[model samples]
Each structure stands twice: as structure tokens, then as C-alpha cells.
Target: MVVHSKFQSDTVLSYSGSIPYTCYEIGHTWEPGCVKTFFQTFCDAFKFSIRVYTVFYLATFVIKLRKKENRRIKKIKKLLRDILQSSIFLSANGAFFMGGFCMLRNLIGKFYGWHGLLAGFITGILSIQLERKSRRGMLALYLMNLAAETLFNMAVARNLIKPIPYGEVIIFSIASAGFMSLFRQRNGLPENLHSPLTLIVGPEESRDFYRNGGNFSQRWRLISCLPYLQKLLQRLKTVHRSHQSCPHNNSCTYYTLEGIFKQFLLGYGIQILLNALQSLRGKQKWSKVFNNISLASFLAGFIGLFRACNCSLRWLLDRDIPALHGALSGAVAGTTLYFYRSTSIALYFFFKLMEVLYFRGIREGYVPHLPSADQYLYASTLAIILHASCCEPHNIRPGYWKFLCGVSGWKFPVMFRKLFDVFGTKATTLYPNFVPDLDPRYVKTTAVMELLKVHGKWRDPTNF
Candidate 1:
């Protein structure tokens, strides 16, 4: 009869009850050691890259198809070319980083949690070189956002830092304010810098920024209050109803309600679609449509509150300072983040704001232009993510973790944690959730690595 205990790899104390040899590291029995792991990872990355690129590029192609300006055949060709480029960059990036980890381990005969950082850094610098230069900056910015959040979460987990109250709200507020100012002059900027506010507030209305009605007549302030009231009422009733300083061509009440309804529907539709996706994944009941209603409410409330605040400010000052209006209204609208409390969205926008500002500085000659900065930042951020994911999985963002798992062929869980335990990362605590790649109960025979749903027989992990 076969004897079993928890798949402990740290010690070799038993024969039948001993930890499997493959458990000593990540590679499965059929693919023992570092060299085999590299080849295995290469295959996984290649297959996953095609699937990921198809999904992304297919959606883009469908969107571009709506615009008749581009020839259909040309668009299809572009799509195929982009997908090819993407696959090469992504496959190489994923394969090298993952295989790099094992490669690094082999050099020293053992690996620690921090070794993932070195592997990631080397792989990132090398892999990014294969990517299109035009795409590097955006990729760097996106990775920077994830890295910042990961770093902060890790710090909090270690009690090295405390969570800030309403921090995301504050960050979103500042970034949104800056974005609004930029959006006002978007005509001079990249075509892709569109904001949802343009759709909700009306393009014409948003474009009329910095409009200032001259101060009210002193005579009206002293007397003829009735005429002044009449003038105000007349302005509200007119087709282009708005304070002289206001931009919209509608009564404040109409504009406010219109924005509210449209924005609400926009947000609601998005949330519903997300819920539908979740339902497909069997994560939640589809009937519970209102379960995450606040996510929609956050967007709807933001539009309403922002317009109300901007109108009030204009009415109070009897004029409009476009800068003040944008800043204050954005700040007020930012409070809506409290409805959903999404740390991820806020953190992303914070990095995005910094990126935009830095770019602006470069254009204005205030910031130095650094070539390859994007790749460097990308490498640095990837290292942080690699180190954190390996050493402190608990701190990684759930979506990011899931994405990493998919890209890595679910190998994150199968990583041999016994060596990492030396770093005092509390890795053993996470060990129970993941089976070692070489567990006797579930030996892998083929190159395709999948975690089977059924647990054949798990021996209660015994302490060595």
C-alpha cells in the first residue's frame, strides 16, 4: 500500500512517506529540473499568447469596422499584423520571465522568493525590446499603476504602512481635475484622449470653457431687483438657457436631469454587462442584478454632482473661471468614489495623471526627455510585480493575480515554495492551497499543465 503525508519538500525524512523528488522544485516528473521547465513554459506562453491576442485584436477590429473610412481588407490585414506582433512580444515576455526564474535557481542550486525579481527584470528589459516602440509608453504606464498598488498593498500587509482613509477618492479627484483641464483643449491633443464627460455633458457645452459673463450692473445690485430676477428667469427659459458664464444651452434643471439619466444608464449598462460576464464564469447568480448597484450609482452620481456644483459656483460668483469650475467640480464629483470604493480604478488614474503631466512637461521643456525610459519603467515595475507575486501573493491585486495565473499557465501555484520558505515570507501558509507539481497523487505526464478539479487524495500535511 502506498503511504502518504502532506507534500512537504523541505526535508527528506521518509521513504514511502517521504516528499516526492519533483516536490524539491517546480518541474513535474516528466519534466524534471530547470531546463525542462523552460521548454514547458515556452510552449505554454506561445499558446496563451495567440488566445489573448485574438480576443483583444478581434474586439478592436470589430470597432474599427464601424468606421468606413478604412478599407475592410486593409483593416483585416492590419489586424493580422498586429496580432502577430503582439503574440511574439507577449509570448517571449511570458516565457522568458517564467523560465528565467528556474534558470536563475539552477545557477545557485536553490532559489529564494526575491530571485523572481531578478528574473523579471532581466526578462522585462529583453522582452520589451521586441515590442513596438509606439506601444511601450502606454504599457509602462499601465504596469506602473499595477506596481504602485501592489507595492502599497504589500507594505500594508507587513504593517510597514497604514491604509489611508478616502485616499482613492482624493487621488481620483486630483487626477480627474487635471484630465478635465486637458480635455477642454483636447482639440490640440491626441484623438484618443476622449472622456465620458464629453458624451454626458454634450460636446458643445464642455467646449465652451472659460466663458465669463461680465459682472452684473451696479445699478441692478442697488435697485430694480425685480428686473434682475426677471432677467434671470428669462435666461433660464431661453432655448440656450444657462448663466452667461455657463456653457450648456439648457435650463439648469433640464441639463442636470438629462445628464443624470444618461449617465445612470451608461453606468448601469456597464455594470450589468460585467455581472453577465461573472454569471458566465459561474461566480454569481445572474438574477441578482442589483448586487453591485453602487458601481453604477458612483458614475451617475458623479455626473449629477459635478454639474450641480459647477452651476452653483457660477451662480454664486456671477461668473465662471473655467479652471476653478473644472477643478472644484471634479473634486466634488470625486466623492462619488465612496459609493464603489474601488482602489484599483483610483490608483490607475493617479499614475495616468502623473504620466500625462510628465509628458506635458516634456513638451513644455520643463521635463527632460529620456529615451527608453518606458522600457526601464516597464522592467522595474515588472520586477516589483514578480517579486511581490512570488513572495507575497496575498498582497497582489486579485485581477492581476488572475491575469498572472493565466499568463503563467497556472504555474504560480505549482511553484516549489520549499526554497522560498527561507526568506520568512510565510510561504508555507500559502502552501496548502497549491499542490506541488510533482505530487504523487496528481502526476503530470504531458506538457499541457492543468490543475485538475478533482483532488484524488490529499494527505494531511504533517510537520517535519
Candidate 2:
């Protein structure tokens, strides 16, 4: 069952003008660079949203307040710089390795197989290299990644989670932060480099554990007043422990039945409400901003779905599915959704609405009709439910993609306009509302953090 290269096959099949069919060319759809480029674009887009709406606004409010008479302006300024730098790095590279390896698998289909066994191995190794900025931090990232790889291998090798639905891994991932590297850092700093880090956000007790000296901020002081934070975390801990059951072998990890059930109910309920909202509101500035968040989340979710489809296809065909499936899936999904053609478009809109409402949008200055500050609690509840509902085996229909319009929407025209322009379109022109007028301090501090990792100055805070 050898796959004949086009060179060997005299018949060349090439069609254009939006014919619905399958693609076989290796680099045509799944080229590694193509995969990376789309995700990079996605990350940058979302990064703007995070900065302009959330970090920038909050930082300005904190810096401008005349009420804090005791605090010096210089200190406020420094804190602002630090917070923005850390957030940018996290948003930019938060999903870097997952997205990177997915890209690489597509690009190097010759080397990697359907199970992504090679991709996982390569991902495990490369994560240590590209992401390594500090020795200790690198080590920690390596260990956490190793744990992830081991779990993936177990799932493949023993079929430990077989017929368990492909998205179960994602559920486990979100619940445990399995794809993320975690350790004790001064902030959510990159373990491998010094230039960028997310400011570690937690309950006041957790903050107390990380902070030096007795000094604290007024805002944080208010956070400490909430007595329920620790109680909630303790409950989470108990649930986490229950999910940690070892099934004789330590090869794979998955969501707890409780976590899965809880998340599905809540997330689905939120999604329903969001979908209802989409029916009512036309695109406005705030709505557009929220829509972008929805769009990005939709893209991410589609990627997850495509990955599952490819894995399942590999299993069914008894042949290694090409990485191009990953690339092709992304391109197809994006092109399809952007053009408003595919049936999945409906799913995309619904899920995207859910994503913005529950996970990211509200954090970035979106306020609901409700005035309660306990929005996060509700969002969290929604996230859990939607995650579970989306994971249901019945929700997926991978092969059926017939109902699609070949073209619609302005995206294609806009792309063509850029392609033909002698003078390039301004980079910031597309997302005018979200562009950040960033300071040099944020860049400098983030660069320093990454430099430390690349230069070998970083040590894992957890190790100490």
C-alpha cells in the first residue's frame, strides 16, 4: 500500500475555483510554516485584545488614581511596566508549544506518523530547546512536558482512553493546566527566558506565599478580604486529588468524571445564552471586540476538533494520516469560517460566543448586564459545563462537509487587495480599535526575561 508520489503517477489532478474535494499534496495544506503563521497571527490578534482592553486599562486606572496618597508615582509606573510585559509574553506564547508541534508535524509528515508519536517525541525535545531560557526553568518545562508526553503515549499505546472521545485530552489539559509549565516564579515568568512572564495571579494566600516582605497593595488587600477564596481552592484541591487516581500505570491523565460532568453542564448553559445574544446584537465596537475573541476561540476549538478527526482517521484508515491534515484542517476551517460557508460556521459562532463570554472576553473589559463582581465565578461555572458538553462523542461529525458556499464575505476581497497593493497596507489598519500604544519599558523588561533564559541565567523557582 505505497502512496505514489505525483512524479510516479502520470495523472495530475489539480482543480481550482472552490471545488469540494480532498487534498493530497504534502506541502499544499499542512506545511509547517503555514500552520505556525495562522496561529501566530491568531496569538498576536488576541494579544492586542488582552493588552488594550484588560492590562492597559487596569494599569492606567491604577497609575492615575490620586486616592493612593502614600504610594509613589515611580513605583506605580514600574509596576505598570512589569504587569504589561508579563501579560504580553503569556498571551503570545501561552499555546506556543502545542501550536508549534502541530505545525511541525504537518511540515515533517515524512518523519512523523499519525499517532503523532514522532511529533510528541520531537515536541518533547524541541520544547526544552526553543523554550529553554534558564537552566532550572528549562528543566521544569522539560519535566512537565515529559509528563504530558508520557500520558499521550499511554493513551496511544494501551488505548487507555479509547473510544473516550478525542477532546478528552483537551478537557484534561484545561483542568490540570497539563499543557502549561508551572513553578514558583516571582511572577508568571518564562522558565527558559527572562524577558517575558505572566504575573502569577492567585488568591491572596497564594500571593502571600510568592511575595517578599510584609508590604502589600490596597487592591490586593481587598482581595484578601474575600474569605471564600481559600475555601474554594481547598475544594478544588480535593477534587484535584480525586482526579489523580493512578490506574496501576502512570502513563496517561484525563479529566475526572466530576470535573467533566460539572464543566459540560456549565459551559453548555453559557454557550446557549451567548448564542441567544448573537441573535439579538448587531456588530458594534464592543460587540466586534467580543466577536474577535469568539473568532479566536472558535479557531482554537476548530483546531482541537481537527486534531481529533485526524487522530480518529489515522485509527480507522490503518494508515498514518499526514500532518497536512492538521494544516489543511486549519486552513480549511479558517478559510471556510472566514468566508462564512461551512456548516461548522454555526458551531463556530456558537462556541466562539461561549469562549468570549466564559474564558477571555469579559476579562478584557466586557461587562455583562449584571453588575456583580463575581462574574469570574459564573464564567468558571460556564467554562466547565461547555468543555464537557463539547467533549460528548455525539457532537462530532468529521467527514460530512458537503453543505458549504464556495465564497461569501469580505475577507477574500480584503486579502486580494493586500496581495495586489504596491504599497503595503498598514499593519495596524485592520484592528484599529485594539492597537496598543506600548511603552519601551514593557518590551525591555520582557526582553531581559527571555535573554536570561537564552543566556542561562534562569533557575527554576520550584526547584529551590
Candidate 3:
């Protein structure tokens, strides 16, 4: 009797037989079973948390090392510390909220769609309340969450991406937004901040500094040129004032509007240049360039109008409720752009009203007690463990991933430099003839020589 194997290496075997025998390849890998999957998920979650903690810790450490004697440095340090604290709290709160949302969704089987929306709304409110102590921050978080959910649903409807489980997505978005808002809250600086130029040079000297072609740094190059720009503005203002007799109070408004318009025009010009360059790179036709220019001009004009309106509102109210003003201006912009649908518009309005009510509540001594730092940490650990056990891995992309990637890319060069320093020294000493190219004096001296020259020149008072 002859027997045939039903399986072959790297191929399926076919045979007609009453009895079947299967043979397996020696080197093929099998799919992960339940145990392996659980271990892998746990490891991934732990690594992610560690990465988050390490990145923030290192960043804060770097900022702390800067000279803190200067007031600006002190303020920057405080801002960094506050940011680190807020981020840790927000991440912890978000994880807890997500775990609860997933649990609720799993428990409730019928009307999955309604269950998801309700869960998302509740999670959003709770997440915002826990993540931020300020009423303004909370309101902003709520409105942004609504807007994001609306956009995501629209994208799904249009088949831009696969349908997401809204509950899971909402939880992920809240966490992602919390991190983003923490960074963006103060324009990547401390809150209620003055310009660094104003801080560095007193008001009297700042004019001269600007007049001298401000060379503070690459970031503040624009500020250095501001004095020259302002002089031209003043000249134009004088021309307008001489042409028309205007009261001082009315003149201030006119000047403010004029500044807004000037800024808009300047930005429009820059946009056109950038669009032209992009068009050249992409080999776009003239029609596309015209469309780009037109769109850019429209956006620039809208931004200018929004700023003018915001300034007017602040001037009239004589109070600084930037959150309220921002929402109102954003609504106008949204309406002008035809960006939001009826549902989203209504939701926005509802959030605006809620923001007012919430502000009032806080004013009336209704501030909610927030969780302590220790509690936040404990909750985060528990939430992470629960999520690892019960939920599939979340694949939501963060808005700042590109920024983080750019930051992390620097590590490779730094590591390579350090390795070369250590190995080059040892290799040159031990095997000079065999590894002559590894000598640190030859390979790494160029940068050091350049720095030495700069230092020597700067040390001579004549250079300064």
C-alpha cells in the first residue's frame, strides 16, 4: 500500500484518499495564539507609556538646565513644568475615560450607533472636566471634540477611510487633543506672555534694536525688521490723518484696522510666493496656480477680518474673555467658509451656550474638585492594564506625530557623534595604521576648530 501526505513544504498538497494525513513545514511560523497575543499587547502598552514618560522627562530636564537667573528663562521653566504636569494628568484621565467607554459599549449590545454616540459625549465631557481646571480650556475641549467627531463621520461617509468604531475613536481623539491643546494653549509659550523682544530690550531700546535690523535670532528675525515696518506704517498713518480730519479715539480704531489690513496683504504676498514655488515643484499648470492664489487671498482676507472683529470686540467689551471672543470669531469664519453643516452648526452653538453657563457656574463658586496627582497616576496604570487586556490595539494617528518624529530623528546623529568620539579615540591609539580614518583628531576636528575660531574672535572685545 502507498500513502500520500496531504501537506507539503511551502505549498499545499492535493490528493484523493479515504484517509487524510497532513504534514507541516519545518520552518514555517504559525499565527500567534491567545497567550502570545496577550503578552505582545501588554509589552506594547508598557513600551508606549515608557516612551511618553521618557520624552517629557528629557525635555523638561533640558529646559531646567537653562540659566534660570533671567526672568524670561524662569518663566520658560515654569511654563515647561506646568506643561509636563498637565500632560501627565491629561493622559491619565484620557486612558481612564477610554477604558470606561469601551466597557460600556461592550455591555450594551442593541442600538450600537446610539450607544457609541452617547458614550462619546459622556466621555468627552468627563475627559474635559478632568483634564483642565480652567473653564475656558474645558469649553474649548468640548467644542473641539464635537468638531472632530463631525469631521471624522463626514470622512467616513465620503469613504475616505474605513468606518471607525466611534466610541474607540472618541476616546483616542480626547487623549490626542489633550496632548495637542496642552502644547498649543499658549502658542507654544507661556500664557499671558509678552514678546521675548520686549522682555529682552526695554521699550525705549526696542525701537533702536528694531531700527538696527533686529538680529536677535532666526526665530525673531521678523521682530528685528518690525521697527522699519512700523516706521512705514506711521508714515502712511500720517498721510491718512492729514488727508482726513479724524478724532483721536476714532483714529486708534482706524490704525488698528489698517494694521490688520497690512498684515493680511503681507501674508497674502508670502502665500503667493510659496504657492508659486510649490506649483513649480509639482509641475502644476497656470490654472492651478491661479486657483491657489485665489484661495490663499481669500483665506488671508478672512483671517484679517476675524482679527479686526476680535480686536473690536475686545476694545468694546474692555474685558479679556479670549475664549468667548475666539468662539464668536470662529463661528463667523466657519459661516463665511461654509465649512460646517446644520448639525455641526447647532452643536457649536450649543457648546457656546454651555461655555457661558459653565463660566457663570465657576464665578458663582461651583468649582469642581479635581483628582490629586497620585490618584491620576494610579488610575492611569489601572486604565492601561484594563485596555491592554480587553481592547484591541488603537491605531489612531496623532496630529503631532510628525513633530515628534522630527524631534526623534535628531537622536540618531547625536548617538553617532558620541560613538565616533569614543571608538575613534580607542581605535586610533590601538591600531593607528589599520584604522587611521577613525582618529578623532582628523575626523571630528573641523567642527571643533570652527567653534574655537568663533570663541577666540568673540573673546576679543574688538569683534563685539
Candidates in order have lDDT scores of 0.67, 0.31, 0.35
What is the Cα root-mean-square deviation between model 1 and the actual structure?
A: 9.1
**Model 3 misplaced stretches (Cα beyond 4 Å):** 1-39, 49-232, 239-254, 261-303, 306-357, 365-464
Q: How do all the candidates rank in terms of lDDT, highest first?
A: 1, 3, 2
Clashes of each: 0, 25, 1
TM-score for candidate 1: 0.79
Location of the lowest summed lDDT over 10 successive residues in candidate 3: 20-29
lDDT of 2 by residue, 289-408 (tens): 333233333433433343333334444565432333333333333332332223333333333223334433446556544443233322232222211111111121322101000010
Q: Residue-wise lDDT of candidate 3 within 365-406, one digit each (tens)?
A: 796534342233333333332221111111112332222222
> Candidate 2, after superposition: displacement of residue 155 in Å?
2.0
**Candidate 1 residue lDDT tens string, 1-464:** 21222332234432112222222244333345556666676677768887998999898777777778655787788888888887878777667876776566556654444566888899889889888898998888888988988888877866899988998988888877776656655342344565555665545335534434432233135333687765664454453457776676556765565566667777888888898998989998988755677777888888888788888888899987766676778778888988888877887877877887787889989999998899999999988887766666767788778777666656676665533443545554556455443444444322112322233332322421
Candidate 3 deviation (Cα RMSD):
21.5
Clashing pairs in 3: 214-224
- After superposition, the stretches of candidate 1 with alpha carbons farther than 4 Å from their true spots are 1-30, 69-71, 106-113, 185-189, 195-197, 204-241, 290-292, 433-464
Residue 437, candidate 1: Cα error in Å is: 5.9
